[model samples]
Target: MEGPIEIRGLTKVYGGGFKAVDDLNFVVPKNAFMGFLGPNGAGKTTSIKIITNMLSATSGEAIINGINVMSDPKMALADVGAVVETPEFYPYLTPMETLLYLGSLRGMTNTEITNRGRDLLDMVKLTEWKDQRVGKFSKGMKQRLAIAQALLPQPSVIILDEPTSGLDPRGMVEVRDILKELRKIDVSVLMSSHLLNEVQEVCTDVTLINRGKMLRSGSVASLLNEVKAHKIEVRVLSPPALEVTNQLRSFPGVKEINYMSDVVFNVDFEGAEAEQAGLLLQLQGMGLKVVSFKESGLALESLYMSLIMESR
Candidate 1:
């Protein structure tokens, strides 16, 4: 079956001969939460604009649900919901009123708007303030409401551009929680974000881009597997003796070990998950009280940086 979103040879150029997007091609598979990752001015937003039919592409196709956006924008976008860049609404309108108004624009009947609007308000945790004016809401609340509005249409595909941008830490977390909820539904999502941690947390698949060119695209697990080595931090109740440390250093796949303190150290491990499990078992068998064992550093962050650097 065709994916919900596909880009083939999509490119965008400005008047001065500068290309903002360059032949980008990828697919947002059915029910997949895909992250569109890139650095600033890397053409992430430009590509999204083309896909959403907000801007004309220099060359290429933006297909949504098997419909070409350029050829039939209204039909192509009928079941598409997008929150592009920062979202703003009339301060005077309440959340319900706002949805009702937007829904009307989308040709929804009054009954349909009220029923879905109420349910969506609850989904976004804005039920208490559904009737409250949007002007008094915080940035986080507004962002949440924006997501609710996008979902009001019961879209088959959801597109978001930096949904958590310009928000505080709590606000970012709230938006991320909403995104997590999105994954539970049947819709396919394409979220454009530069924040690696955010993408890693909420997206199952990722496509990396740099300078408007495609770098790599795959499931998060597959991309992480491309990183042959992993850093793991282990904490024990007490420090190990020098001989025990030496034994640990000699363990298979232990490239290096650095002691951060008496009970905490990091292991540069070179192997897959099974090898990592072996290392953990070896630690427990050493007669040390193991407190915690977890991977250190963002593997995706490392891959993203390397790809971006290489592209440059």
Candidate 2:
């Protein structure tokens, strides 16, 4: 059997019936690099804890493989490796110590633990600093150490919470690469990130949630395809906003216009890119100042914002 992830009626409630996750449902096919996305306070972390058996869910059920998380927390965790909410480790523990400690908790013998821990450290590029106390490590270095420790159990499923939250550009690349390597080893990954570009970089599929409810779930390509809308950028030499907007409203393909900045506007188009030239010509013919015009690809940030706004 593969590392299929299943969630059924997963719900979580806090004090006074504040539902953290409400009736969420989805499945990440085996070996999937699934992105779990939501804004802050959207219950991403709470849901992850329940799935990993760290916190008992208020109700509902979840399973990885055939392991019932609520009924068999130990066995359910046997093949799951997770770095949740900024990984925690003893400040006195070195990278090596952290992995060894995790290995022991997983019930591996010392020899087996040492061998696997070394390999993981090497894989995460932490071999040189394995003996150094984690307290002395940089943020990126500590994050790498967390990854190494997560792999010590040779888990089939890996979950990372905001894995790139506080990372620099280079640190982000390191964490992304580590995720890619995990796929090579056939480990399924479930990652939560508010960074749209970061999630777009590594996730094949995604499940978006808001206010404790599942909002969307599907392949990235499929999700994008669902949005048939296109956008174009128009830069006028020197034009007035209302006049230009009114003029654009009469164009064949233009649906709406969004002012990007001074002298820049993004025109939403219902037609194709080939029609953009005609639209610009129409502007010029109307005696409106025209400096530059070009087509713009849909931005994930824009897409997410639009979706969320429309939902409300």
Off by over 4 Å in 2: 1-3, 229-231, 236-244, 252-255, 260-262, 269-298
Clashes of each: 0, 0
List TM-score per model, in order: 0.82, 0.87
- The alpha-carbon lDDT assigned to residue 183 of candidate 2 equals 62
Of candidate 1, the 10-residue stretch with the lowest lDDT total is: 301-310
> Per-residue lDDT tens digits of candidate 2, residues 1-312?
234678888999998989999998988778788999889988899999898878889889889877879999888878888888887678898888887788888898889988888888888888899898888788888888888877788888888888888899999899889887766778788899888887777888888888878888888887876654567788877755577578778878778888888788888876544576677778788876878777675455555666676656
Q: Relative to the unseen true structure, what is the C-alpha lDDT of residue 223 in candidate 1, on a scale of 0 to 100?
A: 97
lDDT of 1 by residue, 158-180 (tens): 99999999999988988898999
Off-target runs (Cα >4 Å) in candidate 1 are 232-294
Error of 2 at 183 (Å): 3.5
- What's the residue-level lDDT of 117 in candidate 2? 85
